[model samples]
Target: MLSVYGVAPSEQLFKGTSEAEFPAFHGRPVGGPVLVDCKVSIVKLGSHALGDQQSWVWKPVTQGYAVALENQPLSSLKNHLRGLRTLKDESGQNRLWPWFDPRYLKLVLRGLDGDDLVRLFGPVTLFAFALENGVELFSQQDGSLQVKVVSKC
Candidate 1:
């Protein structure tokens, strides 16, 4: 369901079946790749939100950065996004938006591929269960939407 290596799979990094990929990465000082629990850390950003890839288009609603994202501006968000696409765990590799950033800030994912869905996750958006880590952006203009993150824990 996620990438443990924080980036796309390198042939060197592809240790086993794809089914085992986790959501986070941990590199050993010795060399090569290793997977870590990429589980989403439970955080309440409080009752704050804004327009995202999922709802209200370009507008502000009950919006505020999650506590984890406090003061995290667009540049900070870009830094976080970079981490997702870089795979230091592998012998060698690079790609655009290879992995997912678990902690999201204000910016939206602009050009996610329909197939490479790891690029589409965000603090806002809804793609059904077909998509992972979705946050529905709701507006009075768009009726009601609910957000739910199931804890694999």
Candidate 2:
């Protein structure tokens, strides 16, 4: 699993340390919350305190730079989400493990423009996308409430 930062799905984390807009830690906003998409394979499930897991041998997923395009929001229609529903793959081909929880994350993509997807996302992948300190999400939703997108350390 890999983590990314940015509004557009194609955008990735800052190339170098000096280029990171935020601290790469929780509770920090690097940009305005405009729908950031993260990989579920980057998370460590079945833990009390789930922290980010990165490794030297483990590299982040490559940007599906060639297959990404913004479409209509997934919730725009009733059960429309079920129309092109998917898990794991960037576009419904990638399947996720059972240990992961969709309640903690979201699959509200599709509205995002692009076709490039994560060709090789690891099992530990997870993400904390577009959110504010006080973003309000219903109990039915995963992750924190509205995320605040601001520059972090």
Model 1 lDDT on a 0 to 1 scale: 0.27
| Candidate 1 residue runs with Cα over 4 Å from true position | 1-68, 89-97, 100-153
> What tens digits encode model 2's per-residue C-alpha lDDT throughout 37-140?
33211211122112222211122322211111123221221122122223444576543221122222244321222231121111112233222221111111
- Model 1 has a clash total of 6
> Clashes per prediction?
6, 45
Q: Write the per-residue lDDT of candidate 1 for residues 1-153, one digit (tens) a residue.
A: 111111222222222222222344453322223232232221122222222212211112112122123233434333444455443324556423223322222122232234223333322233211123334331111323334443221
TM-score of 2: 0.19
Q: Which stretch of 10 consecutive residues in model 1 shows the poorest summed lDDT? A: 1-10
Cα RMSD for candidate 2?
16.2
lDDT of 1 at 65: 21
Candidate 1 Cα deviation (angstroms), residue 47: 8.0
Pick the lDDT winner: 1
